[model samples]
Target: MLRTYFPLSFISTLILLISTCAYAEDHTDELHSATTQVTGFGTLGIAHSTTSQADIVRDLSQRSGVGASGRTSLALDSNFGLQLDQRINENTDAAIQLLARKADKDFVPELTWLYAAYTPNDRLKLRLGRVGFDAYMLADSRQVAYSYTWVRPPVDFFGSLIVSYFDGADAVLSFQDAQQGNYQVKLYAGFARGKSYTGHADYDFSLDGSRILGGHLAYQRGAWSARLGYSQLLVKNEYSSLVPVLDAFHTAPLATLIPDAAQLSAELGMQNKRIRYLSAGLVYDAGPLQVQAMFSQTSTNSLNFPDSYAAFLSASYRMGKWTPYATLSASRPVSAQIPLQPPANAPAELVQLYKDLNDGIHSQRNRQSTLSLGLRYDLSDASNLKLQIDRIHSREKFLVRKEAPDWNGQTMLLSASYNFVF
Candidate 1:
């Protein structure tokens, strides 16, 4: 039997919130003079997509997007976050972060990070609890809008991530070479539960307890930084929504047309599967020019899930308080097309099943590229305003919602945002 596992962070957050509230009633003085610091960051934004056939979304977690949801919507990139950092001792510290965004119908807040760090020596540090997914360069700080040049992370490269945090422990080791080149190595292991929003409903995915491990190597020199990373996960998921589809495959009439119906059913199930990811990133910054590039690939053991490749490059130049940038990004599935064709004389039920199966396949497949041009004006040290335009060429359905049958895939997007940190 299979069951959905709720994220542990939710329980932890409730416990912490209650304890702090009760304690504050008795020790308000201690709370005010405690060794703690509070900080926050957010983005106020709106966007428009030229086509009304489908709505463009930042990631799979969002239920609505920019086009069909509205001509202009704040749900795409607008968000807020608050963080508290407390120093427990000279060698220990703890932090918790709460984030609010349009993941559902309304702005709901959730605990994104809650971790305790211990540093016993200058060269090493350890952390335990729910930590950010550090699979790529921007994975940890992707929510801090003021830290990046783009209005949003490129959809082709960042939209496919399934989870952002994992309950785990990690160690970081720092080293310095003879020429004073700095290097760092990080290793982590954890269990996670996350969901992807299918047009119908949420599909819960589990990373099976302790079935994840990964590491990354990073190097830094004068005006350059480089990183290489690898990670693998074991998936144990049971999609309750797919029961009806599987039943039809096993039925008498449809089974007669597809003799290997049982095999096909097994291929559609997502259980005891493993996925591997590899990534590389480079950045250069000097004076008024900065350039960034990254590449990643994902391969999975499931037959219906396609292997994919994604990459992006961005360049920006700063002139006084105004900066201009350009970026190009693309992603596509490399796996062979699924062989799900049914006979022409098949029954009505079989034809309907074919359409259902095809849509499922297309949901995971991506073939798209985008060219973005944008400019940023600094409002202050803690805030900035940006305007961007993207010419999107989507050969296949990409990061979008409510795809219409008669819609073409070509479109343009105009976006603006105000980013601030405190």
Candidate 2:
């Protein structure tokens, strides 16, 4: 499966490159005078974890002990991506991006964004086809540049319970006035139906989902920017006994040992299941100093999963080639009622163990916090380097008979990347 998928993804990338080159050649005369350009950027990173309790794998662009207890191993966070832009005419253009990474257990390149856009005038623009929505000004650009002064965006705050990339269409409208300063309002609605990899190990749920609607509004004057945005998603899962069984171990204890009969009854009880989220953010930038903060909450009633809330604050200062930054983030689980045991006919030991586990798990509501600090250096216009360290503390107790183990882990990471426009 790895061999087959790798080659297929490579072939598709090759086709895109060739097509882009061909298009450039056909418009060479226009290219000389046109502002259109093609650009590419990538990162190469390596890090090691010092603690034995957690494995240091590159989950995203940072080295963290997250999900390390199962397969504690060293890993790399290497990724490459490309962007293409064509200026069809003044005030109108098209652009697309592709990214390859070790997001899955194997290497695969995914279509990050592909869209045609018309700027029309400076205050408004329209886009069609797989557009990238900048929920925050820096949100869309987060992963592309490793120069951001953090091992990774605080996971507690940025983690999405559902899918990341969205498909379909969107638009942006801006309003500018001399006395009122400048305000940008963006409205977008889309639907996406595809398979996405959720970070959890137990569930490899194939997604047949759609994004109902979302939008962002921002006001900026001088060095300060404030944004308010809301987005909602409707996701459906195709049942798989194997995937659920694997995921159950990680879910709350009560949901883990459900009997076959109880599972059937619960399925019947849940005729409708939906996951939804809403988020907002704010940022301020002054000479040599920058600050940002965000808050998000999510709810899913049918999965017996608790409603979740996350928030983070980050600040950075630049001095010459070096920029130092600090970040703090936290998340908590909501409350929910889930199944705890099977039928009376089940094994005596199994039933007893299940009860003990469930009781322990119920005590562990959502509770986790992370602190990070880092430095960033801009080597040049096309290259940069970054180093970041993270300390994570998970307070939720496990449902096992014994007390859940405490997670106090530290992670260090070094990363470098280059960007070029062709």
**What are the lDDT figures for the candidates, one per model?**
0.78, 0.57
Model 2 has an lDDT value of 0.57
Candidate 2 ranges with C-alpha deviation above 4 Å: 1-30, 33-36, 55-76, 133-137, 178-180, 193-199, 242-272, 336-366, 396-422
> On residues 112-188, what C-alpha lDDT tens digit does candidate 2 reach at each position?
78888888787788988776545444566555655455645666665443344567777778887786768877887
Per-model TM-score, in order, reads 0.86, 0.74
Clashing pairs in 2: 333-366
Q: Compare the candidates by TM-score and give the number of the best one.
A: 1
For the record, the alpha-carbon RMSD of candidate 2 to the native fold, in angstroms, is 6.7
Q: What is the C-alpha RMSD of each candidate to the true structure, in Å?
A: 6.3, 6.7
